[model samples]
Target: MSDLAISVRGLTKVFGGRRVVDGFDMDVPKGAIYGFLGPNGSGKTTTIRMMCGLLTPEAGDGTCLGFDILRQSQEIKGRVGYMTQRFSLYEDLTIRENLDFIGRMYRMKDRGARVDRALVDLGLAERAGQLAGSLSGGWKQRLSLAACMLHEPELLMLDEPTAGVDPKARRDFWDEIRRLSARGVTVLVSTHYMDEAVQCDFIAYIAYGRKLISGTPKDIPRLVGLQTWVVEAGEVGTLEAALKADPDVAQVARFGAMLHVSGTDEARLEAVRQRHPGQWQKLDGGLEEAFIWLMSGAQDNFAGPAARGGA
Candidate 1:
């Protein structure tokens, strides 16, 4: 418990009589880059809010940064920096103004020096006078991060922080996140990009308000128990149709000119591979394949009783 930055159990939240986050549990280690992953509308946001003291859980109990999530939420909030899915900063204000405003909101001491340092640290000093509204997606993201770090909080909860940023900008954002983790600041970020997810030290996959799996990036696919083979040929489309017809191939996914066929039974998958005339290479399933397989089997809680029954 001492080494954990966040620990929660049976965390539940309901909206319109439907459980958005149902009996969720999690343990995020201190100074670790933990990836919070899930399909859209899977309640990842609600869970993050509950863990960081932004939203109260109707059920469950836990602590964040040594403060009780329920009883000491204010204490927890003081130590956590939360960035929402959407940019929440004042767009009309300049980068420096936004950081200064955030500092004032926290009533931070030495606001000028702190804002100046944040500007330099995030490479925003040259553009300090630029209005946030005029900045690109990448620049706005950098400003948001700079604002979040003004108080030097011990924990950061970023919800889809790199969604619209370019490839280089995304890479730069992750580099900073790594630096913060190295300095003992725990970071929990949600992302849809597989490349970004692989950068995390730990990952948790969720769907339909339920946590399906959590582990180190290297172990997630193995833990899901999938055996996969990559098949490539000139007639990939034709091969894909034939592979899908085989009952043994539980999952068939097209990756450019190749198809990833996966299943729990290695022997069955091998049989399907032998039946197809292509360049079949047996390999361990990747995170994308594991997630696709996981999501395909998940039941949508919002569906009607008949739909759920059919599913």
Candidate 2:
């Protein structure tokens, strides 16, 4: 078997004469947890669909799980599990019933045994008889994951699986993902949450269907070449406007009480700081700062007046 679980290159997809994803490429090794990070409407979903063979790319060449993506889509589908952004299961059914139904769909040899194992594996054995509709957001997410894994797929594609889930629940979900990876299951997950992105083995940042950067989280900051500083003071709003007006401040965002200011040119950023001495304090620029700077530098493909609702 190939070391790569997914390999695609020159992938392009267009809708309404506008490129939603353009010349995309990615390589994911087996058992690796790859994070796909981007703003909403940045083509992250489109790219994932193409990689998983759910939607054909307008132009691309690739393989998923060693199957030709263009010709062996069916084979790829069977070996991969996809969890959509929304809750897609029958809420009226009990948790156990849902797993049983999925097992039957896969035509597993022992559907009952598979369901029993799934219940235990996801910590849902005690609540097996409870209606899925009655479960909390976190519990519902767990049920969705259980359904996806019932067939024991080699790769899992999760799209914002933890959105709206509590902090503890999100942490637990990631723990489960890591545990699965240890057992040699490859995962490709898309998320806007920075905390979640930090958990992945590698991360790819995409915008308007174009891949901007892909590497470990630590490497991405260096690749973007951003110099960031945190500013905290009494008149933060005033300082923010002043910083935004400066040519050197490429990006400025408020995180609680402090404003994070960043720029690609370190020398220019320092010049701006010197000009506004004592107005802002300098501090280390973290991953969030780098991401903001990177995103600010990207041209939004959906920026036109007509693309407002479409994006």
Candidate 3:
């Protein structure tokens, strides 16, 4: 029994002459909420699939839940729950019926009791008789999560599970995830939302099929060595454009009336600030600022696979 739920090295996947998931390595501790963050087409989903045994990696050696990912895929599958990005249950069936069917598929004994317990645990007991297709986005998400947990797998992998749901629904989903984690279920969740990323025990930021950074959200900013300043003033649009045009300003983004200006070069950033002293106010760097700077420094995999390296 290893402490790591997932341990892999040199995992690679190529498609149509493009290295969708380049040589990647990961070590996820047991019962931890590991958030996988990246932009679109950054290979987040592909990497998750390989790790969970849904897709075989072109090159890699690892174990998932103490089972060999390559040689014991079927055994691994039985002990892992995978929630896809979209709702994948039988929408035409009632919530209870859908859950019962899943229990039967897994061939679990006491199917009725298991279904009942799952509904109660996921707060779907009230909606048990409702057709899944008629439920709102939030309810649908809850039902999907319940179905995934019916088998009670030790490891859970969720890919963008909160995508189109409302804010309240997203918050509810995260609450359930945290509860599961507390009960000793390891979770690997892929998300683009920074708010959700903060909730994870640790995060791995991937870009162009390679992981650029991995650490606690608080440690990521410090690791990147970024200096940021928040600018507040009238006519923020003018200030944002001015900062974006300057090479000294690595990144500039507007948040309501305030603009966030950041750069890796401390001296150059100071020079920019000196020139626009009256137009902007300076403040400390934030997680979002650090993430933007990290992304800017990463090389896009447009040319080909990333050369083997470490950050």
Off by over 4 Å in 2: 278-285, 300-310
Better of 1 and 3 by lDDT: 1
Worst 10 residues of 1 by lDDT: 302-311
Per-model TM-score versus the true fold: 0.95, 0.91, 0.92
**On residues 1-311, what C-alpha lDDT tens digit does candidate 1 reach at each position?**
99999999999987766778888999999999999888888889999999888888999999899899998988887789999899999999988889999999888989999999888887779999998899899988988888888889999999999998999999999998999999999999999998988899999998777788999988988998887788889988898899899999888999999899888887887778778878888765388888888777665443554224221
Arranged by TM-score, best first: 1, 3, 2
Residue-level lDDT tens digits of model 3 in 1-311: 48999999889988766677888999999999999988777899999888878898888788898888888988888888889888899889999999999898888898899999988887778889988899898888888888889899899999999999999999999999999999999999999888999899999998888888899888887787777788787877887888889988878878998888887787998899887765555554377777776666665343333533322
lDDT score for residue 118 of model 1: 87
lDDT of 1: 0.87
RMSD of each: 2.2, 2.4, 3.3
Report residue 102 deviation for candidate 3 (angstroms): 1.4
Candidate 3: the clashing residue pairs are: none
